[model samples]
Target: MANIMAASMYMKIALVCMLVGTLLFVIGFSTVSWMVSSAYNRWEARGVWKVYSCGTSFCTYLSYGAWTYFGRNDYEHVRATQALECIGLIFALVSLLVLLLYLLVDSCRRRNSLIAFVVCVFAAVFFIVVGIAVFAIKLGYSYHVGWSMGFAIVGAIFMFVGGIMGILQLTCR
Candidate 1:
């Protein structure tokens, strides 16, 4: 009984953080407010998958495979950012699922499984930071950063903290 109680504390903490990270990743990935442009710029808001035009009220969805651009460069950087974000989201989701399994299924609470979960969490954070870096590099501080980027950054920080707690659990064991 004591063992189960002790394990649950750390596992629950990790699960909650992973969940927040995954949710933030989704919100940031889909929202059209990653970079809000100034009055001088042509676009009003920009996301990984969509762009809102300052001139027009409508927003344009960026098709992944189409490789289209809106009166600008080829948007090669956008495509790369999209791919990296997708990969990071996948990793985050999978790691969260594994953590859930650890919480619900007794057999999955082994040390090896915990190690794998931590590895995936680290990978998710790495890919997400890389994607953000790639996106930021494209504009080079010309546009103002928006809430979407902030969400992603905070999400990564939460996940990292949770992973550290998981490590503490391991060390304590």
Candidate 2:
């Protein structure tokens, strides 16, 4: 009974952590500030999908001129980073389905469900970590790394901890 209680606690923790991680990752993944730089009194920002200017209080994604000075010309690994992070985001979102299944289906409440969810969480962390690492490495030192990168890293850490909690939940059974 004690072990079952402990496992239940772990499961809740894992679920909360994974949810937070997924939210953070999604925010960072969408925002246009993963990389930022200022030149000629103009601020430019880059995210997974768009490169825009944050020179004014409100950013303008339509500013093609903004990227001419940075981004693609300067970074070789941008596309790879996008691919890895996208894959990670997809895995994280898909893992939530396992939780839904466990809640809705009697058979999915078994240990295998926990294992599958944990594996998906871990896979998400793996791809996110690699993507962040690649971006951090390939991005020029002259530029200022933005909050989006930090968010992505923190998100990956949360997912990783969640995965550990999930493993503990499995052991209790």
Candidate 3:
């Protein structure tokens, strides 16, 4: 039974990692694409592009919020804190998914699209590390060795790469 439980825990950890990793990857792609699309639209049209640009900004900020919230420890109101964090995560994930569909269908030929794809893969890897950290936390593992700043740094690197891609799109494409 102990062995079975350990296996189950491992499986659970893997599933969480996969889901979260994929979601983060999607979010990274959406954010960079949103920036590129909004920039292009802003110059092409009148101020009408504000709507789309603002929406993109909102999504980017929310993605950051989701990551920060989930990455924190608010133990006073555990359920409420976690619920809010989950909501943020869900919103970020959904926005990314929508943005991905748009890119795949309407903008695959763009340079930013390829950059987005690469960032997504990187984000996925970081999320897997985060998942492992979460598993360690649950199993009463050491914080320093388990869920440490390493995962956070990895996540930051993904966003940084996405930002660089966004910047490059302005001049290169």
Q: In order, what lDDT does every prediction score?
A: 0.77, 0.78, 0.35
Ranking by lDDT: 2, 1, 3
Identify the runs in model 1 with alpha carbons over 4 angstroms from their true place: 1-8, 41-43, 56-71
Alpha-carbon RMSD of each model = 3.0, 4.1, 21.1
Candidate 1 vs candidate 3: which has greater TM-score? 1
Q: Which stretches of candidate 3 lie over 4 Å from their true place?
A: 1-74, 77-84, 107-145, 148-153, 170-173
Clashes of 2: 0
Query: What TM-score do all the candidates reach, one by one?
Result: 0.85, 0.82, 0.29
In angstroms, the error of model 2 at 64 is 8.2
User: In model 1, which range of ten residues has the least summed lDDT?
Assistant: 63-72
Top of the candidates by lDDT: 2
